[model samples]
Target: MSKTLHHGLLLLRVLSEQPQGLTVSELADAISVHRTVAHRLVRTLEAHELCRRDHQRRIVLGTGLVSLAEPVQQDLRTLARPILDELAESTRATAHLLVRDGAARMRALMVVEPRGALVHVSFRPGQTHSIEQGSGGVAVLAHGPHREGERPEVSEARAKGYAVTTGEVIPAVTGISAAVPARDRTATASIGISVFEYTDLGQLGTTVAAAARSLGRLLD
Candidate 1:
């Protein structure tokens, strides 16, 4: 690879690991590059909006990377179409697939939404939510990281192999979800469904968990 391209990639890899981002000197030390060279590379990235300095003056990833990654979510949605359809049809509820945008961010973005019934719930793809709130988020967190004192909901999810919630993300709607395990240690994705009401919780949870396992295997 060209020297400048190699340096740019090195900086990106290093920044990808640092949640709070990094300073030019710290980045240089991490990549074993000179401060001047690191500064130049960072400037190039900043000009393209691939990287930018945050309020703390630390180098951080910018929206350019998000644009580049947008297609990845589309691809995931396509790959998950059949499974999502099966889930939506089985439950007769709006089925959704959510994935984390980046490794360090705890934000989960809705990547797919498959309609179930004519009166089913409606949700928008590309919507983002806290990874600790809804069933979809908890599903990802059940397999992802947690604070020192983890939440009871997440613990329950891990034990049950699925997460269920009511009025969490959307008031008056119940959600059932299971995590789509990733090969790596990242939070991985989640598949879920939303409904106005569910009479049989156990059966719904079982079906969602089964769909999640099948999706996980396909992803694997």
Candidate 2:
């Protein structure tokens, strides 16, 4: 790709991470470009409505990006609804679908949740956490290249085709997860259910793995 286009895309990525946006100087430093070069790229993005300056004169992603993302998110929710609902019902736990961010920090993207019981563990949409923390994260990690310093449980999850963790992210809550196979070389994702300690985890892991397989098939 041309250097000019690469710089513009780089600016977009750096801006997306900063919810409060970034000053021109910050953007310049992030991209290893001079302030004038960053400004030129930002102007080109602004012309296409891909980026905008906020009231504080910090650069932010513009509404055009939201238009691009909303339809994709809606389609993903539609595809996962039946599988997530089934997983939640079968296990009597709150079911979730998490995707990897593919960023430097390996954040887990909270994509879907179907509540199981009258009282269920609720993680809000768009929530993110370190990919090393819980069962859902480990499940996705099992499908990818293992990195040094990763939790040892990922290996067991890879061996068993499922992962289970207790009170790791939330005290007294248990998480059972399975990796959803990728489609066309896309990023790997996971499906999980969070339940109380009393639930029969052995059975639930099997159920979750089945649901994950079904969801993975749908992804194709």
Candidate 3:
């Protein structure tokens, strides 16, 4: 379409990645456009209600995007709930769906809660992280063989059905194995379960595999 429209959309994509909002400079740096061009683009987005500028002059996603995103997120959550619950029961531990951030993956949603008081792990709504060498991260990155950059081992993970992060991302946790049913289009998500290693690998593996398969069906 028009130059303004194209630049506005690109600016919106950059803003979408960050919840806090971005300065005009940050946006310019991220998309590698000139500062003036980025400012004009942001102003256009604001006019359309797709972006908003704070008092500090930072840009954030606006009402117009919520209008578009609400429907899609609603459907995804509805479809994923039952599968996440089933995975919780099967694994006898926490099961989660994680999305990538920058170069890492952080916990996004969970269907289970850790039981013990002293040895407890919980995820909050605003959790943010990287997509390093972890099971959940690797699975989402590798499952679709989405080797667009920086990860040659992602191929190994795809061929192996699931990825195992043996305390690479976390400490003392034996491992997490996860599967990404759909990474080609929906790149920021996967189905994964954590294990303490003292638990039964055979039964847990089967359970998680089934859960991943079920999730895969939905993604397909």
Clashes of each: 0, 0, 5
Tens digit per residue, CA lDDT, model 1, 78-105? 6788888888888888888887655533
Best candidate (score: lDDT): 1
Per-prediction TM-score? 0.79, 0.71, 0.67
Candidate 2 lands at a TM-score of 0.71
Best by TM-score: 1
lDDT per residue as tens, model 2, 1-220? 7998898889998886776789889999999999999999988889888899999898988877767766876776688888887777776678888766534223334434444366678776667666777787888777777778777899888888899888887788888898888676444678888877544667888888998888788878
**What's the CA error at residue 112 for candidate 3, in Å?**
2.3
Task: Write the candidate numbers in order of decreasing lDDT.
Answer: 1, 2, 3
Alpha carbon lDDT of each predicted model: 0.81, 0.78, 0.66
Off by over 4 Å in 2: 1-7, 10-36, 46-67, 101-119, 186-188, 198-200
How many backbone collisions does model 2 have? 0
- The best-first sequence of candidates by TM-score reads 1, 2, 3
